[model samples]
Target: MAETGAPRRQSLGFLLLYALAWAGGAMAYVPFLTILLPARMTALVGVSDVEYLGYVTFCGAVAASLAGIAFGWLSDVTRNRRGWIAAGLVLTILLLLAVPLAKDVWTLIGIILLWQLALNMVLSPLAAWAGDCVPDEQKGLLGGLIALSPALGAWSGAIATTPGLVSVDGRLAVVAGLVLLAVTPVLLFGRPRPFPELTAPPPVCADGDVAARPRGPAVRMWLARLLVQIAEAALFAYLYFWFRSIDPAMQDNEKARLFSVALTLAVPVALLAGRWADRRDRPFLPLVIGASVSAMGLVGMALAGDAGMAKASYLIFGIATTVFLSLHSGQTLRILPRSDRRGRDLGVFNLTNTVPSLIMPWLTISLVPGFGFETLFLLLAALAAGAVLLLATLPRGR
Candidate 1:
């Protein structure tokens, strides 16, 4: 996958629409998975909501993983990304509407499972679609732009959860509407110019063995992302609890606000960093630096004595990890296993996101309860450091 002809650049319109559409995918999932599903289960089951919610989440993750791989492969085989993405958007919205209609816990779980499949039908193809279109020259800025997804996702969560603003079913409708607004424009108007070389040129390994590149450094990048993701999953689950352990008087909204701010800051910070990466032609640098800073933030967390330092440290870790993940999203496209199978390979890479949820719970159960968050933070810091090491070994791309 050598660089061939000059880079083909798309207009800002396609880029923005593509990023919005990407963010819209997050809008579809983040609120439903993080907020609506739990709330709905609680409404149905009262005090025993956790049992049902757990069943739904576990099954949904499995469903998403399988659907991501399968649909991604299908898109690659057929060479049709927009068609799948459009179909997925329709199915996803329909499933969102179906969510509120479920009467029983099992029925809700069934909807969630199908919803997961439909959501990936949108996400997996959409992700591959980027690879099909955006050139390497602009991928860094694309990374920056699409960083808005999680922030937007978190914002939608806030809107949905606002007290007395809307009824529960209305909240789902709002989510559906937002998804439509974000995605439909891209399908209707977007015109991405495909990159010439879909798979990037293989990188020289740290030991100067090109054989060790593993299909253009995709394996190392994937593994590094997995390590960082494991740390992120643990923190996402337990950050508030750790904050509570620091100060028992804190309220949930306060923690939520902190998370919102951190996510918001990531946008501008990532934009600058990503644009810098693109101009310098060193796309992977931010990921390495972000991981290192994330480790330092974890160390700060391990040692902070009071809520002030803890919150500040959390902001640091949160911003860094968010930026790292977002930039990685775009950069990963540059190093896919193969152009022809980009979507399917991306599905394999999506394991970094889902597998962490499965692994983090066991990790937290083993460490945090008995040893405290200090130990957990230290361990996570090491993991982030490991990511830095892996990233540093990859060949620096021009």
Candidate 2:
């Protein structure tokens, strides 16, 4: 196999368009979980129970993981990654429209399962596609775009949840429309040319000359990423409830505002971290340092009692998370097994992302009642610590 050279930088217009499309598509799930489904379940079915919601979300996570892996594999075989993305967006839009009609928990869960499956189809491919079109040198900018997804998604979700501005059903309808409208143009107009020149590599020797094979250090880096993501997912899965527990009187707008603040802090930090990774070539050190710092933030949240302290805790959490994620994203392409299999490998990698959601429900159920949310944060801190340890084990190489 020939070594494909580094990719050229993508135009700023392309990045903006892709980011906007992703934001629209990504917003659907967060608001549904944080605001819509809970409200709807409470009003329509009298099932405003947290335990039940946890279980439902756990099921959705399972469905999403299975579908992401399945569809991602199919996309690889079909060589039609964008086609799957389009199909997913269409299905998710239609499903969101159908959600308002569900009268029972079972019906709502069924619809949610379908929606999640479709959404994962889009998400897994989209994640992998970043590695596909973007060059290693440009990964910092690409990583910044990737890191922006959560913040953008959170902002969109907050808007959808704004009181009296839109009914839950109305919000769903609007989000679906926005996603479709934003994504259509990108799909139609922003098709990236496959960089064949970059794909071809020089011949390799038996020992160290393999073109696309990630070295030992790179593999270790990716493993550390997997660990860090799991910890982050676990924390994210329960953050809304954590806030509510700390301040039972907290309103939706307040919660949204706090979440926004965390994300606001995170986004710029992630961008800077991505740039740092690109400019300095310091992958493992940044990941380790970021994880350790984030663990401290989680510990602060775990121990905080006052509202002001909680706000500060979240700010630290956001900054640490942003730095960790940005560094991870920038380093991932350097460690992939092969350029051609980027989609498939990234899909597999995303299982690390999805699997934590499956475990979180069980973890919450087992821990929260007995040990409380504080213990959960402590456990998250431990996970972050583990990630840092793993990251430190990676060999240092270009």
The candidate scoring highest on lDDT is 1
- Which one is best on TM-score? 2
Determine the C-alpha RMSD for candidate 2 after optimal superposition of all C-alphas. 3.5
lDDT of 2: 0.73
lDDT of 1: 0.83
Q: Residue 365 of candidate 2: its Cα lDDT?
A: 83
Which stretches in model 2 have alpha-carbon errors above 4 Å?
1-7, 44-48, 197-223
Q: Worst lDDT window (10 residues) for model 2?
A: 1-10
Clash number for candidate 1:
0
Model 2, 118-214: lDDT tens per residue? Answer: 9988876776666666666667666667666667666766777688888757988866776777677777877665556443443567897656674
Error of 1 at 240 (Å): 5.6
